[model samples]
Target: MRTPLTAGALLALALAAQPALAKGPATSPNEAATARHYASLIAGSQPNMAELTLFFTQMPKGGDLHHHYSGAIYVEQYVDFVDRQGYCVNKQTYRIETDKALVAAERAKPAAERNCLSSAEIYADDHTWRELLQRWSNKDFFNHGALQPPPDRLFFQTFGYFGPVSNSNFKEGLQELKKRAIAENVSYIETMFKLSPAVANPDFDAKAWQNANDDAAFDAQMRAWFAVLDKDPAFNKTIADFVARIVDSSEGIDDERFTMRYQTYVLRLLNPSLVFSSMVSGFKAAKSSDKIVGVNIVGQESTNISMRDYALHMKMFRFLKSVYPDVKVALHAGELAMGDVPPEGLKFHIDQALTVAGANRIGHGLDLAHETNATGIMQTMREKDIPVEINLTSNAFINGVEGSHHPINLYRKYGVPYVISTDDAGVTRHTLSNEYVLFASRYKPSYAEMKKTSYNSIRYAFLPVAEKQRLTRQLDQRFADFEAKIARLAKTAAKAP
Candidate 1:
């Protein structure tokens, strides 16, 4: 009886009104109180410590996407594992050493004294032992007494110092990290550890392409690397062995449902040609293996080589897209500052990472505010739906940025998607809970907003769509159960008065 326009308008009106009428209590009173308390905490009002602590503890963090496996294991734990294996620590450098020198040292010690100190005791010594932890990872920044190295040096040195032991037992290494994630109520870990073969070989030059120009030569070199990962049975056998080791070592542990994804990371500080080759190599590996999910450009973006190679890396990604169209990228961009590097760099990392490299996700986008034509980048990021991984403590500790200075709130304000991550929690002696607490206490996120952040991790993740949906449903049910428990506890506490 009615015209089509009239009927459509009427349906729209009804649909708009349905939610308000059907879902009565869209915002809970308790949620409002918690939001108010968060505001007070951010505004310098010391809210009840117990409630604040409870809020963070029960907050369900979705997943950690930016974790590094080696840096994720506590330094003390790594020391314990090695010492238990009867390894000797270098007294002068404090490096866990091997080869004849270390073996002789171990043999020289008295039988009763050798490997006798507990990890807890070793870590307690501030003068010699704790200093080793500081130097081997990112902990140097936290110690007021130690002479801290520059952020770039400290971060990269950690890898070289612990490289030997880390590679020795990747399977046991993963189990340790998985158990830590489960204890923290985290379900998935997409870590940046172990390199794809190209990044591993000693002959792979760090400075070979300082001036390389011939595209043909570069392609030839890439084909050789690809041959190793694709054609060589030995290389394939190594990957198979690593996977079996992880599965075998992780048997019989029922913590949180844990999963691992490889991020074939390239050192950005290499020559432009080599960096480009590594990018292509990483992408090829991702396409060729299920275990490898994505490619990452790691190392210090502040270095001259890295800065110079930035644009080329993006261009390389664009070229590789034709060869491996399905491979994903999650790059470390905008990890620099105006004070940290030249003006040219401060302006472009985010844009290049998103538009050129086709990054599905971005890591440590700390310099978002400083990028030039940033409005366009923000608009593009929002339109494209790329999520930036935010690491609160890592930013505060390594980059020396925090609170109001961090770009996280800006992303929230602009409606840009994001996920919270612990870039190197083990090094900082923090956990997912600590980062969530920092968000609640510092940024004043509502419980609903915090829950939204949790979901963002899985949603923004590179997991298969079906797997993502399954995990999302599981996470939602878990959160509902968590909220019900908190509600009952709140009622009991209120009734006590």
Candidate 2:
């Protein structure tokens, strides 16, 4: 989340941390004095702006658990890939237009008339491209803008714009994303993506739900959907081929780690039967394959379909949990703010997500105060050890929730495990490191605390226990190496003067 404290408030906080600033010092007097004097100016007793930024850039963020595989990748890569494919970026909205005929037309035009002239040209006119990017995603490139939609709308729309190109080449996309993750010092990512292409059509999906009250009818419809999957061997083949590609490409990378887990996500705003059937299919798939780890209900939870069927979805998961007990779940719950929906609507999302859906993890539990008996909810999560995946940029962009209004500090205060994530990094124009920077600078998390967040991802991941243990050890070694590098850099920087 962006800083909610005003400049004056931040200045005051910085000035007030004088005594605490006196404690820790570098070995060298010059560095120690510089650090001490700078500490006096931090509200959270964080490092100075320059050093803090360097820390952020160098921080070894362990994994990106809440990332969207396609959206987690950098946009510059997409541009280059499509340029080679001879695809044209739509002139009006800048969406990637991959039509072969349109590509031909775009090629016919002079390079200047092409939708994407060049990266340098785009950066040269940063103001114009930034405006377009804001429309595409919820980026705070230009703070003073009346033209951009609300943060939530802009952030969500980015997916729609990038979806076409993203879906076209999953293997290439995953490979490129893994490469960047390696560069950014990230290991392991539990990314969200639709699995098996078995999503119910909206029309049939609605009719299926009309009979949801009748268990037999609902069961019949589920059978029909499964039959559709059975009939379409191509769908299964697609998944098999995709998984093969991922395994082949991610063979022996040393710098970073990669593990793929599919979230058989259903559109929450869909009909109840559709959502229930999807969950059933998701479980059925995960039970059959190791690659598809869990099920998730996504999209705006504030919508009518989502709010009305919230309890129903949870009950479905509960029922499925009995059968496919091993199939993991990480739900999107408590994503709404107080004013985004009705007062009553906010009262029970987190509770239902935990008690009803039996979610092992939750994405964006931002509206903690909105739940009924939030204290009990917090207690339940603590006892259950269900971690809340906090996507700072997404929360700030989508719900306008930040700073004191956010429950990050509160979760810490309550001992509820929480890990920071980039819910949709591409949509937010950020990397995992950027999210860490915001937290480190604003929250002043101690080195141990930051490392704890990395450990949390493994604890909550759907990987097998043995794999998790091995990864945990690897992560500890990586953390040590990272700190050594940082310490070495500090020494070198000290020597330069």
lDDT, candidates in the order shown: 0.69, 0.68
Which residue segments of model 2 deviate by more than 4 Å? 1-47, 109-131, 144-146, 199-260, 486-497
Write one digit per residue (lDDT tens) for candidate 1, span 1-497: 11222445534544553342223332655545544444454555454555666666666677889987777777766777665555656546766656655566666778555542334445655565767767776665755675777776777678676665666666667777777777767777788765544334434444335324555554465556655556667655555554454445445433337566667777777655456546655665666666677888788788787776676677567667656878888989898765788676788888888877788898988898887656566566666888889888888776779989999876776556788899877777788878887876777765557777888888987779987887788787777666666666666765895
After the best TM-score superposition of candidate 1, give how far the Cα of residue 302 lies from its true spot, in angstroms: 0.8
Candidate 2, residues 372-394, lDDT tens digits: the string is 65766666676678889998888
Please give the range of 10 consecutive residues that has the lowest summed lDDT in model 2: 16-25
Task: Tell me the deviation in Å of residue 59 in model 2.
Answer: 3.3
Native-referenced Cα lDDT, model 2: 0.68
Q: Give residue 189's error in model 2 in angstroms.
A: 1.0
Q: Estimate the TM-score of every prediction.
A: 0.81, 0.79
- Candidate 1 deviant stretches above 4 angstroms: 1-44, 47-50, 84-86, 109-126, 138-143, 199-256, 272-277
**lDDT at 17, model 1:** 32
